[model samples]
Target: MKLTSTASRKLAALSLDEIKEAQQEASRQFEEFKARGLSLNMARGKPCVEQLDLALGVLEALHARSEFANSNGDDCRNYGVWNGLPEMRAIFGELLGIPDDLIILGNNSSLQMMFDCISQGYTHGYSGCEPWCRQGDVKFLCPAPGYDRHFAVTEYFGIQMIPVPMLKTGPDMDLIERLVQDETVKGCWCVPKYSNPTGVTFSDETVRRFARLKPAAKDFRIMWDNAYCVHDLTDEPDQLLNIYEECLKHGTEDQVLIFASTSKISFPGAGVAALAASKRNIDDLKLRTTVQTIGSDKLNQLRHVLFLHDADGVRSLMKGHRRILEPKFHIVLDALEQELGGLGIARWSHPHGGYFVNLDVMNGCARQVVALCKEAGVVLTDAGATFPYGADPNDSNIRIAPSFPPEEELREAMELLCIAVRLAATEKLLYERAE
Candidate 1:
């Protein structure tokens, strides 16, 4: 039968013979894919080669003839600017919508800075508060289908993770509000703009609610990891509510620590990362962070500032990125639509901008689908990697990172993925029918 996109028909709606035929066709395609011995990967959200080439000039931005002093004449080659170069902070300050005084630059990984925040809370706590480790049974709110690294950090710290439902607007605020009422719920991880995997930015109401949350712990923090703040796939992308600004309005500015990086914007390994928070939080972070190192790589910060120039420069660079990325994303979306659009067995996110496309297959079928893809020589991010402890209770959500591969390789991998989704879904329906 010819497929139509007008409406979806569930696999359960098909007769046994029809389901068997569909499964056979999908199995045949899977075997053909396997025979090709394709070694394609869509597992990590890495920038493609073209994207990496865009920042080659960042290396040239600084040279032997260039002065190594920051705007304040502080020698970037030497140690001392424990926070960061003044000009670099100014650039991110404007971009992140926080004041210059509130931003603190770190090494390439914001994930490292996040880990430090949790470590400090565990050992020293935030600003005179008792250490979290000393406290009994600490908990954190984890919005599922989130950045797996975020979940991994919380898990490594031995913090109990509470799963919260992520809605199209954002995580369920009603549930988050209720969970944070307990003092043990010390913090929550947030990717406010073009969230990892799901690519759903928080709504204005959701950001405001997050800011106004009356958490029982004074030291409670909202780890706002806005990694994709400017990674817009379209000219007019989703508008993210400024959580730091909203936090200030609610008199809870210290409650959220905002993070951003130039990883995808430029070189991932050599990019600069920054954290923004209230003065109190900044000072507290400085006190703990200073002992760890004399300072971050100010020369690298200078390289970025000199290259990116300012916020508009960052935006311009991202426009180039969108040019390279947008088409690749469309390839995946189009392949999914053509192959599985009218099959009620699968659905996926059509994000305006982000590094990933979140795909949700029929319940109890994601693992099987991923295994099938693997057997066909196409690797995917494991089915449940989006949730805390790598467990998606429904076992349905799969994070598709389409940024790493070339367009043609990506299209091939995605087509194989759709076939696997169909085969696994059909097998599931048939199994249920037999039962």
Candidate 2:
């Protein structure tokens, strides 16, 4: 029997014999894929080589020694500007919609900045509050189908993580609002724009609700990670409300810590990272930085400033990225639509921007699907890596990172992945019927 016609039907509607036949066909396909000895990885959202090539000019942007001096006349070779060069701050500030004074440019990884921020809170605490470590039981509200690394940071510090369901608009605000009433809930992690895994931007109402939150802890903060602020895949991209500005209206400016970076736009390892917060919070963090180190890599900062020049320059580079990335994303989405459109076995997000596509398969089958994909040599992110502690209660929600592989490789990977999904779902149904 042709697997396409048979597999296209809902697995639940198939008879026992039909289900077994589908599984057999899937096993046969899986073995063929295994025989190909294909080796492809879709684990992390690293930019493709083509995307990295677009920023090659940046290496040459500072060839001359005289270019070492920033527009503010600070010697890039020196180590005194703890908040980063003014020109670099202004450039990222424009992209982040933050005032230059409110931003502090840091090292290459925004993840580093996030770790530092959490560490600071754990050790020294924010102004007017005791260190979180001393608080006895610290907790954070993590939005599910969220970034695993964010959960990792909180877990590393022994903070209890409370998983909040992510709605179409954003994290369930009502639950978040209720959770924050506990003084132990110190903060929440938010991707805000093109959120990790789910790719759902928080609705305006959700942003407003976040701004108006009256958490019991005076030091409660919102770790607003806008990593994909400019990584749009379409001409019409999602707009995220400025959480800081909204906080200002509600007299809660100190309640949000915003972070962004050029890790994806330029080069992941050598790009610039930054954070934005209220003056009070910035002043506190800046004072702490005085002892952390003399300053970040100013020479690299100068190179980025000279290369990117300004916000428009940043946008131009991103457009080039969108051209290469948009089609790759289409390949993944198109394959899903054609292969599993009405199978009733899976559903996924069609994000306008960001580097990931979230795919949630049949209940209790994500691990099996990921394992099958791995066995076939198409390596995927671990099945439950998107959730807290690497555990998805439903055993669903697989994050697909299509940004790294070349187009042809991505197409082949997706084909194998869809087959794995079909095979896993059929096996699951068969098991349930037998049970």
Candidate 3:
């Protein structure tokens, strides 16, 4: 039946016949399904196998003749360059849309740069300020439903996490501005473009407010991890408001620390990453990182430069990735629509880009749904993995990573996923009604 505007609760609930019919349609698939003996994962943000194929050439790039030498004519084969070589820094700066001077070339993983920054702040200090490890208490504002690794880093440091609500435009800016005013709040983590799980981009206003934050601690910084800067799956890309430029416009360029990685672009294990920020922040970051090494691999930098001359090369490559991922994405989306379009028990995002699709199930049923999927041999990201400390107060957010699986696998996975979702949601509803 069609739902009328301003309908009452009783009218909104589907009739018993509709529910039974829907269940039967779903049951036929489950009853007819056979054990495919497949052990698949749709849990992590890792790139798809076909997408990963794009970087296979990087192995040759690494072994190529002339690209292995740095600015000083040194061999990258040796152990050195902890902050990364210059050519690599240039590649990262170009990739992330920042000036090379402001970008610090990090090793293979961008997560390490973030982790190292936090570790340094806790110990040595940021830009001549008092070390956070020396402070009695330090707090971080975590944009809820964000990257798990970021939260994991902060949690490992015993830093207190204050959850900030996320919206379509970005994290609730009003709440962020107010909280930052407190002296104890020192930092916040943000994946500005195509944010993990939610795929929400930060609006111009949100970026502006973030740049202008008047934190009580002079050392407070915005951890801007733009991991999906070039990963647009749709033909029409979702343009993001550059937070670094917003900072410059707001006259607070010193407040943002941005990072990007080529891990997803090339090889996750051997890719180069970089950190972009104000010169002041760079100088400070160098103080800690400088002692860590001599220079990053100029060879990989040269390899990427030789391979992908400019941003266009990156875009051209992503087009290839989009081809592989877009169809798989639609497969999951269609299955969700087919199985749960108006059930009033679940909702999910159809993001134009990014590696994830966020599904919010009936309140308190997400963990149960994830458990059900696991029993059927499909591995999913932990139900609460999107939130800080792996705890979702509502237990409703479920991140669906579609990039890793093939279309056929995704279709089957999503079909099974719908059953799991419905079973868990129904049980929760009945149990709650009983209570």
Root mean square deviation (Cα) for candidate 3? 3.3
> How much is the lDDT of residue 289 in candidate 1?
83
**TM-score of candidate 3 on Cα atoms, chains taken together:** 0.92
Model 1 lDDT tens row, 1-435: 433332377666878988888888888888999999999988899999999999987898886645888878899889989999999899889988888989999989888999999899998998578999999899999998898999999999899999898999999999999999899999999998899989999999999999899999998999999999999998679998888888888899989999998999998888999999999998899888899999999989988888989999999999999999999999999988888887788889999898999999999999998999998888899889999988999999998988989999999999899889888987888888899
The segments of candidate 1 whose C-alpha lies over 4 angstroms from its true place after superposition are 1-8
Better of 1 and 2 by lDDT: 2
Worst 10 residues of 2 by lDDT: 1-10
Q: Write the per-residue lDDT of candidate 3 for residues 281-397, one digit (tens) a residue.
A: 888888777788766665666677666666777788889888888898888889887777766777898787988898999889899888878877789999888888899999999
TM-score of each: 0.98, 0.98, 0.92
Taking all chains together, the TM-score of candidate 2 against the true structure is 0.98
Q: What lDDT is reached at residue 230 by model 1?
A: 93
Error at 148, model 3, angstroms = 0.8
> What residue pairs are clashing in model 2?
none
Candidate lDDT (C-alpha), each:
0.90, 0.92, 0.80
